[model samples]
Target: MTQQHRTALKELQKLDSRIHEARQRIAEFDPRFEEVEEPALVLEGELNTTRNRLKEMKLEERRLESSTVDRRDRLRRLEERLGSVRNLREEAAVSAELDMVRRSLQNDEQEALGLIDQLGKAEQRLGELEEAHAEALRVLEPRREALIAERADARSELERLEGERSVFAQGMNPDELRIYNAIRGGGRRAAVAELTEDGACGNCFGIVPLQHQNEVRHGQSLIRCEACGVILAAPEPGSAADAAPAEASTAVTEVAVASDDDDGGDEEE
Candidate 1:
């Protein structure tokens, strides 16, 4: 009965591993979704920036027109005063002021005309960008919908597996299930592993004491690998399936460590 329960836990662990991978597959879609949306995002940003600039330019144009109006009123007042100047001195002073006001009004009118031209060009550019943005969204809709559908399918599979795990865990030995869940919590992936054929921990390659190895092989009680704390189940008879876990992890870790050392050396140089 204990052995049977241990086998159930191992099988549940395998199912959990599959669930983890399915989740990872679903997560991988996020980057692809972002990739597909990037062009539209860029265009939308440009559209917003251009629209804001257009608003500011229009405000500036209105301000210039208001200034032009005030200057026009001042020029009219000065010209009327010129005809009524009391002496040559007064007339000369009025004439000088009139020339200054006239030049200012002319400059304002020229600036307003230049801005009106710019406003026309800006409006045209905005129209072109709007059309392009609309076209991009139209072209992107199909691909984006396809990605959404694909991710939905992956999520559906994950839900099915989770339901299966929930159902499968019922009626198990409570103590054993509790232990399994505790070890599996917090994104820890390797909660249960089989003993390698040579009495070593499959997870970390540490040699299991002969006594514990015997207990694990016989499925006496749940024996955890002291080196890595993964629950040890017996490997399938006459199989090398557990042989590579430690080796593969070790190789990858070694390569990563070597790369780090090389980077450190370059930094030192």
Candidate 2:
């Protein structure tokens, strides 16, 4: 394997990982994505609850009204009986009965009035809830549409990236692909790294010893960083030529092998 081939392999690994991650993310959001009809579902449930409450309140008002009518009919019958009284005892009994009926009618009227007040307040609240519900639906419509459009665009982009990744991966050996996938399984970043001007792994920024750098440059075999366990490659000719002197000068001045243990840390997706 030449250095160029290794670099291409590394780049292909990176692209493949990116494609896989994008696909996973898209899958997660497929069923209940923000772009779907979530807002409509929420609004529908709320509207149904409010309408049910309104229906119950109206039924209660009708029941109260019927009770009031029944009380009025009783009072009318008692008033008629008062006229039939003939003796003092009978008249006193009839008068007492009339008084009781009047008191009962008054209580019924008061209760009816309270019910009317409550019904009015309930109607007003229902209207407010309806208005709020309408406004929420109105606000949610455009947002939902926009999200749907965004998802569509993302899907299209993901498709294109996947195609590109496929093309790149087709050129790589199965063993290379396996290694790349193994690294990606641990985290989002798949490729270990290439060498930088400072003789360090580009991904981990850990120092690459002179021997390791030569191995990576020669491309006799695939190389992985000892510290970070990332595959390493050399930069392109133009960059490598420019980097060679700085690396040589640093190595001469330091007179000590740079530690491979110093890691630059993992790259994020």
Candidate 3:
């Protein structure tokens, strides 16, 4: 009964650990989902940046046009005043100012033209980014849906295993369940371990006393390794099976010697 209960507890511990892992796997989807959306996010960002740049270029073009218009108006006023200038000094000064304004207007117009070219490129790039985003969605849609479905399945399995663990725990002794749950919840990989070949705890590699080994081997008593609190079970059946051949060979030798002794006695008779 003790060994049976311990076996049940060990199974419970495994189920709990599996449940933990499944939950972790489910949690991993958050980042993975974000990763799937990353291409669209990048495209949207690029499109927004291009649009903003285009706006700035257009604004600059408009400003340059306005400046050119203002300069032209000033030049016209100065030219009108040139006809009224009586002295050569006034005429020369007015002519120099007109040249400066004309040059500024030309420069402004050239800059505006350059801004229009930039705006055209930006608009084209924005269109390309939009198309790329749409294409990415088309390509990744299936993968994203698959990921979502996988996460859902994993979550469902986790829930089912959690239910199974609860049901399994009901069959274990309260004290043993408490101990197992404590060790398992405390981050230990296993709450129960099989005794190893050298009579060490399978989990902690701590030496187990012979007396405890004997108790576990009988399969009638529960034993815990003293060094580590994990419950111990007897070594599995393979070790005992390995000794069977040696015992068979010894029996065959004994029969041969007995037969030789009988033949010698018969000869003496």
Best by TM-score: 1
Range of the 10 consecutive residues with the lowest summed lDDT in candidate 2: 260-269
- Model 1 per-residue lDDT tens digits across residues 116-166: 898898899899889989998998899999999999999999999999998
Q: Over 4 Å off in model 1, which ranges? A: 238-269
Report the lDDT tens digits of candidate 2 across residue range 1-269. 24445655766776776777777766766665544556656766766776777688678768767876886787687677777767899878877877886787788678768777776876776677678767777877787677678778778878999888777766655566677768778874646566787788888788988898877766656788888888887665454546566544433222122222232221211
The CA-based lDDT of model 1 is what? 0.78
TM match of model 2 to true structure: 0.64
On lDDT, the leading prediction is 1
Candidate 1 vs candidate 3, TM-score winner = 1
How close is each model in CA RMSD to the real structure?
12.6, 8.6, 12.9
Which structure is stronger by TM-score: 2 or 3?
3
Tell me how candidate 2 scores on lDDT. 0.68
lDDT of 3 at 23: 89
* Regions of model 2 farther than 4 Å from truth: 2-4, 16-52, 66-105, 128-140, 238-269
